[model samples]
Target: MPSKIQKLEPDRTTIAIGLEGSANKLGVGIIRHHPRPDKSSPKPPAEILANIRHTYITPPGEGFLPRDTAKHHRSFVVKLVRQALKQSGVSIADIDCVCFTQGPGMGAPLQSVAIAARTISLMWDKPLVGVNHCVGHIEMGREITGATNPVVLYVSGGNTQVIAYSHQRYRIFGETLDIAVGNCLDRFARTLHIPNDPSPGYNIEQLARKGKHYVELPYTVKGMDVSMSGILAYIDGVANDIFGGKPKYTDDGAEITREDLCFSLQETIFAMLVEITERAMAHVGSQQVLIVGGVGCNERLQQMMGMMARDRGGAVYATDERFCIDNGIMIAHAGLLAYETGYRTELEDSVCTQRFRTDEVFLAWRDD
Candidate 1:
């Protein structure tokens, strides 16, 4: 870590442009951080000039593939960047740095966006900042909700973790041992042949709302970690049985429907998540909890988490879809924070990986 911090004059503002294509969604964002009025004053909220995203949707029952997603990103990255700059009313010269997701995602999509970031960095002669995808979600959640040092529960298609900031790092207290919760839900939706438009998880949530009976499913919680693969497999078998003309009944002898299965799966998995998150909060002696990542946009999860937080005499913080889902603004915000601390990714070191851990990032901007 560099000992020198980048300081700005009171009248100066820091600007950054970020690109994100870690999965199916390709996004571009521009943001500005105004200088603080004084050293003792609180940091002002970030001003989002433009936050644009375009997701590559597959047909029903299909998930996004790395190559296809990368192709989609290459097709739209430049356009989105131009639109973001136009919407923000800022020129390339005004941007202090270019940020992009560095890792913990699909290889092709990460590389596609990285190439764009590097091009922008060279074309505009701005510094490059490589941001961890998970860190982007955490910092964006904190900024949007104004939650100061709360326990973070990051849930997405590829990740599920309970994290807390400590010793200049976001340490993981718990995580999924198998597939992530969102992955389970998404795969279950595919099993049901549900539409992927607007997200399969959202469709499942809608179906779950109409379910009157809850079928039993596996609940796997091991110590501080949770497992969803068993539950997914079991539920998938049940769904297949129903589709194969084998009638499945609930405890009340009512025949199980797809909606009922969706309901049961969601309830069981969310309960497991709540249990572990509560345990983490208890261990850390923190009442406040912040939920981030794409799955954090689920209203049912938010409601369940909120209920658990209230029971602990605390509160739950979550953002809407725009910020909750993967977006470039988060990359810009987190990278700019690092850039303000004299952090930069040299051209030779500007590489993206497929398996970057959240704790690998050193939080130079944070003291706690």
Candidate 2:
């Protein structure tokens, strides 16, 4: 329970600073807006003022290691913060509130973000708001697609789950019991000895596109949960067939080709997701479907969801890398909305957590 929603004049001059530290990416944003009454009340919502997003990519071989990620975050956060503020044309002194991710991410990365926000909040005398990272991703997707109450599929390197809004909170309908989908993709890329350039996920997708023949990748599903470890093993076993020793194009055997494996893998994985999403939509009574998080940028994934939505007479939505792939703007957008809801975190309450389930966040930031 927090402050009661109160009515105020149509505000045209309010700005909020947002900090996102859920993953290795340390993002910061500033948003300007006009103030308004309770969004859930009879009053309408406020207008946005200014918005910004910044992401600091972790150096190679440092993404999953928490200690190394901490160093990366601490080193680049201050500069990024100033850059986001400068780009938004907003002053830290005038920032009405500060927000940062509190959990559902690496503990070291979370601590890095929390410490930065807490330090700034104390120095600026601004109230701090702690937000759930996954929730931020979902809200950002909603803003990008204008999809309300859609079945949300959150897929990232560290997390993968199917979710939908219910009872004033996002409820997890299905998730991986052991490993995430993105993690599997990255590991598969490693098995194929693909250059981990740009992004491993993208690299795998490209190789999959050139591949031909159904590689018969494993597909394991129990109820609503999926296990991709078997699929990874199967793909590794067929690596030699999919990727040849020389770089030259050699069409030798029709039994297995890179394009076929890639196509089959993408189709199988996407079908699993689509199956669960359709089930979740049926259960939630929602027609809209939204894809968010880092993996949401995959065109193949989006296409699968699009086909699923069309089959169900629904609509599928997703944001590009701008909002979908772990950025500062989404964090800031979600933070601004939560701040308007009268949600702020005291310094003592702002502790970084290794595990914060998405469904656990209450109605503090939601509107009826």
Candidate 3:
């Protein structure tokens, strides 16, 4: 077992290197954070020394596999690490800790990056920090947008949740009971044989912009929880029938186009998401809504969220694609925050899992 590491004073500046490979993307980032003595004072700026990422793209109509994604991470993680260190102008000796995503992701992919992080920690003689993926997104979003204690709507291929911070814990107000929102969109893209070069969801969004009409699809919102699997199934059937030269008319005899389906899907799902997010904000009495995770980059979703927040006399906050998508900067930023709070993952205890929940991590850094 690795020896117990000593805690550092929170008043000093700390540097952390974070590795993220919870899914198809592999990222390496370095961050420097300066903590202030006064807890109520403004949060000090967290500098991004280096932030680099690479994605593994599969063919159209295909989803990424665990083994393949792991291999992809292992193959490029070293190169990314080297590049990030060089880009950041920081040597291994300058880093105070190494961090990695621990869970709520693919088991093999998470394991692959965790192994790299553990090896790096031992090589550099730095302590290890385990980061939660969802929390990483939330923290990064807050830092970039300066949304203090906002309602977070985290949407990605693997997760769709409405969250609010309370008692130092990020509580989930609502989430998808089945497949996530991004997963639902990707599967529907596969049914339509859409290319997955950049992202299926991106392609769908682009196609949606060309649509002038809407085709009806099931909108499954059970109170705060949503059921996207049924909607995906229905859309997939519609896409298959349309592609198979079957009747392409709605029940009202209106013609159904591919663009129409995409538009309708985006409108329906995004509206559902906005509804749940608004509900969360109302429940928490928060005026700000912050959207995080990969799918949060969607413009239509942002527009819908903005409208909802405006209706409630509130505001919506979001980051660009760089921070919105899963990246190393988030993990690095979040991990450094934890490290300052005296949280570290010993080498022997840095085991990665596939089911780590966001609320599992104790919040020692936040006073609110």
Candidate 4:
């Protein structure tokens, strides 16, 4: 042979997928990166084989009941999973692991994703990995912003916590003792007679900007834990006064309107998060703060955190909606780290749990 050119193998490969189906949304994601393909092959250029994330929103309206949402999740999983894999340009046989969120969600919905992943893993002869939903949020925050050991303020429909990572676990320095932040926002929006369509929260956020007064809302915080249910009751009382032939909103068309209520609600909730997070920073003795979760996507909340960060000489990092909200990428990214760390779940693993602690996952299983 006069000359021979060696063919090079790709340095990167995708070995895992992260699936999140906690509620009304189903996130399917595939993460890929390059390293030495095998011991015989030298590491090539750093590359991302594929990092794909897709979301399937539950089609039903705001008051999406659990049963219907679960049904939606089941129906959409087949399509979304296929789409994610296809978009990633990864064949089913190439996936080394299938990771799915295991619990802390509606049982029917959680089981739907778990069963789907199980079916795929069994068919493809790959290992199954179950992740924690909350930890997924945290890790996604880290991956997006490159923040490590920052105080975490996670606010969402089901969770509101000021957290710190310590001893291989996320510690809850503070958390919601009552109704979640997003739930309060939605319920308050309903009381304002706002349309449930097109996302009541965004609509409320729009209307809130038009508001210019502080209508007092209760602030409940006890040793880093807060309650919002009573605030809802009290706000409902105010709104009922306006509706019960009193004097507000309905009296003069748009004057003194729902916008005021929305603005006040946002201010109240955002302030609570800021206060608790600030307190946690002091408690943890760390100046860096990372804000993650759906509620963290709120502009007003970001502004509030920004203010606190300035006060403490600390920087606050927030994920764009891409990673902030429940999405497949976060799950995939988190799951990849878990899988690489050798965390795998057996098919016999349980499907449903009411409250699964995030730190309890022994293998990093990647928070679902």
Candidate 5:
């Protein structure tokens, strides 16, 4: 932790509106941060005035495209924004700043949401705060679960990383060298013809619950990082073989089912995650583990993480879909924290990107 830099005065409250549409979901959220009465303490508990989202679901055997996703965001963002403001009962003038995710997502969707956010900031005369998508998830997880200084396992459709804080930065201890864990699941779900109603991963989790056989799949963990491309390719090939009536079976001569495939994939990938997260925790000398991002909502992953943490005599912290999934509230929550440290994204510099790493942002509000 670095020396505290004075930004906000004591006992003052700041309200922010956040916009998020990095991928298939477009979210609008309102958040209020109240400075602690005692300046020595950290920021007080944040209030989530309103957090609303609308998702764009594609048909089975297909993944969402950047172009189509952006169109969906453009269509629904304004409606969600209006609903969020009305639900929060906060007037536009009450908002202190407008926050939006600036990077680490699909280019088209990010740009669409960025345009919306810039419009809002200009219209409301509020300052803009460009937030990193991964940091948003991490900070919101810490705030919601009160897990300070825990090792973070950020898993999502486009990212997989093990993170920990050191020297005023959220350092990445490990990450995926290939496809993300969620991407593997989503693609596999498509191969199985699973519906993408709520989410492909959620549907796979449900199917995995009915699975009894543990079909062996390649479990590849390279040191602190994991690679899912090979696993996905192997599973897809097996699924194709099964679909072609080519008879695939386990080593014990038992036939494989779609349920078994999902079960094996989940168990194998989650174990690799737990292994790497545990390794990072041990390296950092911390026991607490916090899981965030879209894939963190899986109950089985939570259970596996809890077991790993319990074995180390620590605990696992997590949030439900509202905070776990890509949403505006986390962006608002994290951007508010940065804004408290006098961080601002000038209108001219409020550009969105597709490759913002977690360690790029400097943690100015932290004194730990």
Candidate 6:
């Protein structure tokens, strides 16, 4: 496609521009990876040249559809790319590769962004690197938190998994048997008619903070896997009943409020996550736990995870919204790593899929 893959010189800095529109959010980011003087040394830190995103939000009690989300991404991707390049202060010619999310997302949204990436790759004469969405989260989390090797709990809207690195792959130790954790929260938020302005999950977290009671919900954890669909269905019914003026109360005779439902749901789901994550850590014989993805931004989840890791005499690592939420920077960082290892995705093979799994990606940049 391009002339020839550029060699990553040890003394040179590699720059990549990444585009991400896997879901409702469209993002563009530029990142710089400075190489170590000694090639045998461990990798150095990455520099975030520019990180920008625009979200497509629906009204209260609604979810974003694939068609609308794709339109939103198409509308903003080019503008975001331009802004990212300008903010990075880097010329297009200086970019080594154009990276984009290739899978594990809504088909239309992923295709919309991939088309933009393909167009840029051809226009700028740069190679293209297709990144796995889940792998992008893991790589960016490791870079931001410096968690060398940790049992990763990846919680997002479309996916939920507990992972560990092994044999040049991110192996999924356990995952949701039903809907994802974030999806459960989002659906519950819709049941409550909460605003999806910032995020339904964030609003739910805020409401949960004011809760003084806990209404027990189904705890579905079978072996290492967890289930949230039943819980969501159960809670949805409870929420509807409460809204319909049905009497519901806690064990202490206190009437359960909306805030209490949010609180109880958060606690129950987070506990299931903690249980699986701890089990994964034990299975891998590692104490470190790293949380990534959009729902990983939940402070309650982080606190609970931290408590679990501490109980095992280890530490938990998590990032704020910037790195935790889906963004182009993570795609850029992870893609650049693969690019440096001589991985490339030709134009024809750069097609995006909606069902890519985390374990499907080969971690060529990491040792066995």
True-vs-predicted CA distance for residue 295, candidate 3, Å: 0.3
The lDDT of model 1 is 0.92
Query: lDDT of model 6 at residue 24?
Result: 89
What are the per-residue Cα lDDT tens digits for candidate 1 across 205-322?
9999999998888889999999998999899999999999998987778999999998899899999999999999999999999999998999999999999999999999999999
TM match of model 5 to true structure: 0.97
Clashing pairs in 4: 12-34, 131-368, 132-367, 132-368, 133-368
lDDT value for model 2: 0.74
lDDT of 3 at 14: 85
Candidate 6 per-residue lDDT over residues 1-368, each given as its tens digit: 12235566668899999998899888888999998879688777999999999999999999999999999999998899999999999999899999999999999999999999999999999999999999999999999999989999999999999999999999999999989999999999999999998999999999999998988899999999999999999999999999998969877789989999999999999999999999999999998999999999999999999998999999999999998999999999999998997788989889899999899887878984
Q: Which 10-residue window of candidate 5 scores lowest in summed lDDT?
A: 1-10
- Candidate 5 lDDT by residue in tens digits, 326-362: 9999999988888878888887788888999899989
Q: Which digits, one per residue and each the tens of the lDDT, describe model 3 over residues 1-368?
A: 12254678757778899999999989898999977769678868789999999999999999999999999999999999999999999878889999999988999999999999998988888899999999999999999999998999999999999999888888989999999999989988888788997899999999999987788789899999999988888888888888888958867777788899999999999989998988888898999999999999999999999988998899999998899989999999998888887777887789988888887777778987
Q: What do the candidate models score in CA lDDT, each in turn?
A: 0.92, 0.74, 0.90, 0.73, 0.92, 0.93
TM-score of the candidate numbered 4? 0.86
Give the winner by TM-score: 1 or 4. 1
Candidate 6 regions off by >4 Å? 1-7
lDDT of 6: 0.93
Q: Is candidate 1 or candidate 4 better by lDDT?
A: 1
Query: Which portions of model 4 miss their true places by more than 4 Å?
Result: 1-12, 35-62, 249-255, 363-368
Residue 8 lDDT in candidate 4: 28
lDDT at 26 for candidate 4? 78
lDDT of model 4 at position 139: 79
Off by over 4 Å in 3: 1-5, 37-40, 250-254
lDDT of 2 by residue, 1-368 (tens): 13334322445455677777676566776766554455454433333333444444433433447777777789888888788777766677778778788877888878988899999899999888777889889987876677877999999887889998877899899998877888888776666555555677777788777766565567787777888878877766676544555322335645555556567777787788888888988987889989998888999999889988998899999988767777666666777677776677777888978788988787555664
